[model samples]
Target: MAEFDVVVLGGGPAGVHAALAAASAGLNVALFDENASAGGQVYRAPLEGMRAASNADQQAGDVLRRELTASTVTTFFAHSVWAVTGDYRIDATGPNGPVHCTARALIVASGTTERVVPFEGWTTPGVIGLAAATILLKSQGVLPGRSTLVAGCGPLLAAVAAKTLEGGGKVEAIADLAGTADWARTLPAMLARPGLLRQGVDWWRTINRARTPRYGRHTIIRVEPADERLRATLAPCDAAGRPISGQRTTVLADCIAVGHGLTPATEITRLLRAKHRYSRAAGGWIAVADQDGRTSRPLLYVAGDGAGIAGAAAAATHGALAGLACALDLGAANPVRLTRGIGPARSAHRHAARFGHAMANLIALRPGHVESITPETIVCRCEDVTRAEIEAACDAGARDINQLKAWTRCGMGPCQGRTCGDVAGELLMRRMGTASRETVGSFSARTPLRPVTVEALTGNFTYDEIPIPKAAPL
Candidate 1:
């Protein structure tokens, strides 16, 4: 296997920054990203022959990509890391073929995935996640539909609405689960970072200019097919997100884009056996890491949304700190030189983290929302497992998420619970009367963390090279 001083997983803001920092310190760094490009989801680059609507972010990503290319770091784009062993060996499938590499130090910056809670008619053809819609617009320069209803619990709802308008898609309405009071409560924290506040204002201005109907403290109660369109029932929700009895509104649109913020992408970290803690504000279970991104596992670190959902700025800062720390540990750079950059990065991360916390509070998912799930609503779209099925399993004494999985096969699918784990855990927790989500626990990470083709796995090796060990003496 090829070896490196450091290997960084992911190509998002954090991964790129970490690779750059470590390489600049004269460490042989190898960075592997699943995407064809370096920018993570937040700063995803537009596809070839397409231009992104947000020039600033695109330009910023471009600058980082340029710097990464110029650095000594070896980049492997379009590479999916499937398994990472305890010995720091990584097995991945790249554009060419299988890649096996080992590193003395490892950094995981795998980023975040959308947190989707299912509702009635969510499986309908027109429904999509907010992140999916954003990717469609930003990367491919395509709208989800001609007319769309955007509903969610976070700032992404507003941002997607703005992007939809900018991309020439008609936004029927924008519904936010957080009320005006929620925004007011987060004012002080929001003010701590003027740039983030300005970005929010900018999205607001776009929606305002388009005169889109805006609903606060509202959520989609149900949706039904209406000819070629979808009819979504909206209801005013209480602080806990339980729908109010008397208030209801209906929206007609070609499509619905919805999500409840993001959760840390923790499969890799979990597989590595890092300590984790549940933080609702930090976007579910996250790796326990210091400000410098050093995890409980020695010589292993996690940064970006994989550590917590602290947005792009904080992710970059955290990545820098992790890289510097790695450099210090590897003796590639002196303590004074490496330590100098960490203080400012740590401060920036603190400010960004505060903003992230405020935003998380404003858009927090409540237990009431979980209570609202109908028996028929599909909880695990990958496996077609319904709420009723999960409840039945729980009633049958499936105490933990793993038990639920074995009983109902809820999380056994291609997505591997990336889309349904949180909601499923919530359901199991409520049924089992579990005091905390941590008690329910997350799905166990297994080999081939992501889907891989059989051909890719076996085509690279001959039968003799399969490494079948001889039987031990009885």
Candidate 2:
């Protein structure tokens, strides 16, 4: 068993900042991440020789990396935390044999996951989420294809398109759902943050330069595959996400990127029984945390996008604040100095959060977002379960989320049902009479959550044949 004063459960921006700040305050800290590296999805390493060409993204990432590496915090990459018992117990699997670690205080910054809205033919091999496509490019420096259609409902779609083109992929077009009407409603909020508005303009200018068509009020209705590639049908939609007339068009591409948006990464915190609130504007249910980032649990705290759908700047700021809070709770710091030093970070967080709210509202999922899904669609890719199977589970008296999962195995697959949990719940709720909150339970996360190479798990193998105690003694 290993012990620490603080143990952070993720290596993303929030977790990194939390670990570093806590350590700087004179606490022994360890950061555990399930990935092979620290950057998580946003700061993912760009392909071999290609770095993140964007000046803003790169600078932000560099500062974070520096702060983390400079601190006394020890980081454990490729280690998965399976379960947590009480306020301190964490069962993690790593190079060590099912290592058990206990910390006086725990910080959860697991971040968010992609929110996929299923549609007909969505499970076709060529269809992927905006974040998943970004992961592929950032991790391997490879594009899904030469010609790609970026169709999604958030700023991430724009960022992904830019990154795709930068990596030598040809972007066919970008069909965005943020129409002028929606922007008009969002204008007041956008004007509140001039700096963020400027950032938005810069991204638009880059998109314009690439000649990528940015359509507003549009939705993808159908995606057909030809010769093992994808062809998508798009049309204009009103604010309610309904199809408008006379705007139907078909686009040809090898791959399509689509997503509703993101939800807070709250699995670890949910296990701790932290309170959660459903804010459609905040991308869905998120942990209900206090201003200082403290959760309901005395020794447990949460920050960043995991607590809510905030951006990188907001995440870093909250992370720093939480780290300070953790330090104070552990009796490791002088009250006055910690309080004074936290002001600037707090200001940054407020500024970033204001813009984050605006962005979140602007990209809220449309009312009829699930219109594209058909009965034959595969909602849970890991389990190969179709929409029909989910409905059957609901019809068979699996009224609650857990019951549905138990009956149909909707979320009982290898991906831990992350891919299908929400959608399955939504379907289950529609079929049954349960409330949405009651129908959607947390995804099951086990140790070694991500698949690692067999060699990595067996590399330390040593065969020592222990001889049976000789019966000669008997």
Candidate 3:
């Protein structure tokens, strides 16, 4: 069993900064990432022999990668931590083989994934998540399709549209659930970070230059196969995302890239039994943590998107704070080291969080949107569970998400409810007339958190002879 002073999960901006901070403070740290490389989804590295467009954001990721390599932190790439137990013990499978590790303190910075709300024909071959499209374009230098329609909420819509155009892919249209009024309302909070505002302006300018048709307060209600193309039905929506009785439009698209912002990847956090609360603005259920990233569990911390939906800037700041706090807690560093520069980092985090909150509010999914799900629409693609099936389970007296799971197997798929849990919970909430979605409860996390083949587990198994106890005297 390998051990370290600190174990940081994930290799994104947050984990990188945390490892650097702790290592520089004279603490041995091990950083584990599932990817073959360090960069997370946002700042993912391009494939070999493929040159990605140079930018400040990518440059920052490069700098972090270099610093991590130069630091004393031990990095394990292609390592997926499937289970954690007994204080901070971790079971993972790395490129070489299975690894067992323990740490005095643990920092989770696992980041976020696209929050998907299923629509009719969403399981069609041409449909993909906005994050998937971004990865395909940026990392693999592959276009999602020749002509695509980018739909859904949040800043990612515009970002994906702009990236598609830059990659020389024709964008049929860009549909946003938020209208002009939404952006106007969020302007004050967005102004907290002038750079982010400027970046938004730049993305808008790019889309404008492409002359792509941009729709506001609109959503793709359904999609159908039309030969090799996809026919998407678009309709106007109100503030609550309820469809309005207005003229609808249809577009022929080769691909549909859609997403409803992001939700924190909280499987590991939930498995750890850390306290959490539901906050739509924070991207659903998130680990309850303080400014220093300390969670309810002692010596266990969370930072980055795993803690909440704050973007990379805030994630890095929180990571630094958490690292300092961990070092101080372990007596590995002086108290002055923990206090130094923390004030500025916290202030910066606040500014970034303000902008993140503003963006989240603008793109938050309304209840009506979930109500719009058709009975036939597939909610859990992995399990082939439809809205009708879930509704039937609820009608059969399944009161909460866990009961509904046993009744219909909606969240018992390979994705482990990552794709369908939120939507299912909302459906259950509506059926039970729960005051809040949280009342329906989140899916209880169990190990192994990720899929692990039996072959791997058995291959790593070792047999040890045990002394048989003599029969106890009666």
What is residue 296's positional error in candidate 2, in angstroms? Answer: 2.1
Number of the top-ranking candidate, with lDDT as the measure = 1
Give the least accurate 10-residue stretch of model 2, judged by summed lDDT.
443-452
Off by over 4 Å in 1: 459-474
What is candidate 2's local distance difference test score? 0.77
Can you write out model 1's per-residue Cα lDDT over 199-285, one digit (the tens) per residue? 889989999999999998888989899999999999898888878876689999998999987889999889889999988878888
Cα misplacement distance, residue 87 of candidate 1 (Å): 0.9
Model 3's number of clashes is 0
Q: After superposition, how far is residue 377 of candidate 2 from its true place, in Å?
A: 1.5
Q: In lDDT terms, how accurate is model 3? A: 0.86
Q: lDDT per prediction?
A: 0.88, 0.77, 0.86
